[model samples]
Target: MIPSILPTYNRAPLSFVKGEGVWLQTEDGRRYLDLGAGIAVNALGHANPDLVDALTTQANALWHVSNLYQIPAQQKLADALVERTFADTCFFTNSGTEAMELVVKMARKYWHDQGQPERTRILTFEGAFHGRSSAAIAAVGTEKMTKGFGPLLSGFTQLPWGDHEALREAAAQADVGAILIEPVQGEGGIRPVPDQCLKGLRDLCDDIGALLIFDEVQCGMGRTGKLFAHEWAGVTPDIMMVAKGIGGGFPLGAVLATEAAAACMVAGTHGSTYGGNPLACAVGAKVMEIVASEDFLDGVRARSGRLRQGLEGLVASHPEVFEGVRGTGLMLGLKCKGAPADLVQAGYAEGVLTVPAADNVVRLLPPLNIAEAEIDEALSRLDRVAARVGSDAG
Candidate 1:
C-alpha cells in the first residue's frame, strides 16, 4: 500500500518539530544535537537569524518576479558571488540538479557556438553523485543511480576514481568538451580531492581545451573553511555548481561560469520561472555576506582543526568502530571499520544525528558557526555513540 507521501526515504521514526542552532527538538520534545546540519544545507545553523530576517524582509516587500524582468535581489546575489569567486556570471536555480542541467547545457553550447558541435562528451568519475536528474544520473553513469533509468542521456563518460591515467586519456579525447567533479565529494563519503590532484585537473583541462566544472553544492559556502572547496586547491573551475548552504537552508542554487564559457548561453539559451525569486536570493545574499568574510572563514578553520583533532582522538579510542577520518573543515566523515549504519543508529540512541554515506562512512557536517562548547558537547555525545557501538559488537 502506497502511503500518502512517497516512501522513498527510510526515514527515522522520530519527527523533528523545531530546530535552533545545532539542535533539533523532536515532536515529543526530545532535543538532539544535529551534526549533519540537514546534509550541509543549514550552514549558519538551523533557523539562522540573519537568514530568517532576510527571508522575512523580502517576503514582506516582494516574492516572485519572473526572470523576464530584472530582479534586484537576484542581481545582488550574482554580484556577491562574482565578487567572492572565479565566476564572471551567475545563473540562479532552485536546486543543485537544476544547476547541473545548466552546467551541461552551457558546456556543450560553448562548443557548438565555437563551430565544434562534435565536442559534446563530458567526463566524470566513479563515486560521483551529481544529482538525480536524468542528465546528472547519466553523468555519473553508476548502476546504482542508473539501473532502472535506461536510454539515459548520452555524451558522459565515467572514469575510475583517482585514476589519473584514465582521466588524462579520457579528457584528451576529441569529443570530450568538459570534466565535472566534486572538489569534496559529500555523498561519495566526504573525500577531499588532494590539492595537487585538483591542480593537475586544471592543468589537464587547459592542455585539452576542455572546460572544468565543479559541483560544490555540498561543500561550498564555507563548509570547507574556504568560500568553496576548490579554493583550497587554488584552482578555479570554468563552471561551478553551488547550492545547499548558499541559502543557509532555503532552497537555492546557481551555476557560475567564466565569461568565455558562458558566452554561448545567450538570452534565450536558458532560464527559469521560479529561479532567483526575491525570497531565495535575499537569503542567499545574506549567507554570502556572512560566509565570504575572512573573519568567519578563519573561525571555520580554527573550529575545523579542533574538531578534526578530537575526531582523530575518537578514532584512536574507538578502533573497533572507526578506521579514520576523511575530508576538510566541517565536512568531515568517519570511515567506519564496521557497517556505518550501525554507528548512525548508535548515534541516534545517544541523541546525535548523523548521515551515512558511501564507502562505509558516517558524515559529520555540523554548522559552520557551531560554538566551541557545542563542539565539545558533540564530541562527548559521539564518544558515547562509539562506546555503544563497541558494546553492541562485543
Candidate 2:
C-alpha cells in the first residue's frame, strides 16, 4: 500500500468496492455483513435507491448554493424536524462537530444576550465523545483526547457520568449556563444514561433555568426506536444536535432548539457555506420522511428485540468473550471481556463488519431496514468470532 495523504484515522486493511443494503463487497468479490453501517451514518443502508435518487435528482438541478439564497429544500427539512420534535428553529451544519460548535456558541450566547455574560460555563460528562474540533474537544477535554491540544478552551466543566450530586452542585453555581449530554453515550461504549436520570436532569435544568442540550449524533433518529432518545424518558431538551442518520450517508447535521432558547442566535450570529446545500437537504428530507414514519419506527423496535435477544444468547454461550450487552434498539454494544479490536478483526475475517468503541465494547449499528435473515447471519458470524476469540483466551 502506498503512503496516504493524511496520517489521521488508522486505516483498516480491507477496502470495500461496493455496498448494498446491509452487505459490503471487497475488491476480491468477498461479501461481508455490515453491522457497523459506516459508524451509523448509513441509516437507510448503503446505496439506498431512494437516497440515491434523491441525490441524483438534486445534483442535476442544483448542487451548491450559499445561505444567502432561498433554499426550499433546507426549509422543508427544517420544517420536518420541527414538526416531529420540540425544536421551533433549526441551524444546519456540515457535520456533527460543527453542529456541536454552533451549540456551544448558542448556549453561551443565550446567557450573554440576557446580560449575564459571566454565566458561560457548560457542563459536560466524563467519558463523553463530542468531536475533534477545538470547541468540541474542549467540551470533552479528558486526558486521552486533549493531551496534545495545548491550552484547553475555558468555561467548560466536567462531571462524572450520571453523578446527580455533582450535577446539582454545578447547576446551582451561577457560572453554569447549560448542561450538555448524550442521551445514550455512543463512543463511550453504548452506555445509556437511565431514562429516569434523564428526566431528573430535565427537572434540574428547569429549576436552574439552564438549557438542556442533547448530542444525538449517534443515538438519535431511528437508532433508539424513537425520533430522539430523550423521547423515551418523556423529556425534551432545550437544544439538540443531530447528525449521522439525518442525511442517510450524506454529510449533514443540524442544531434544533426551542423558540426561546434559539432566540439568542439573531442576525449575524452564525453561518455555514455548505451547511444547507440543496443536494444534502434533498437526501435529508427523504431520510426524514422514511425514518420519521410510525411504521418504520415500530419496525425498528421489533428488530431491536431480535438483535438484543440474539446478542444475549450469544453472551450466554460465550461468556468468556462477551461479558454483557447494553444500549437500546439498533445501537447495541457487546461488552467484550477479551480484546475488542481483535474480536472486530476476527469478525471481519469471518465476513462480518463491527465497530470497536470505548470500554472494550464492539458496537452493532446495522441498517434500520436490515432483514431478519441478515440479522441471523450476523449473529452466526459473531458466534464464530466469539468462539474463536474465547478459545484463544481460554
Candidates' TM-scores?
0.99, 0.98
In Å, residue 182's CA in model 1 sits off its true spot by 0.5
Q: Which ten residues in a row have the lowest lDDT in candidate 1?
A: 164-173
Q: Which stretches in model 2 have alpha-carbon errors above 4 Å?
A: none
- Residue 392 displacement (Å), model 1: 0.9
Which candidate comes out best when scored by lDDT?
Answer: 1
Model 1 gets an lDDT of: 0.93
Per-residue lDDT value at 377 in model 2? 88
Tens digits of per-residue lDDT for model 2 on 67-94?
9999999999999999999999999999
* RMSD, candidate 2, Å: 1.2
Quick one: how many clashes does candidate 2 have?
Answer: 0
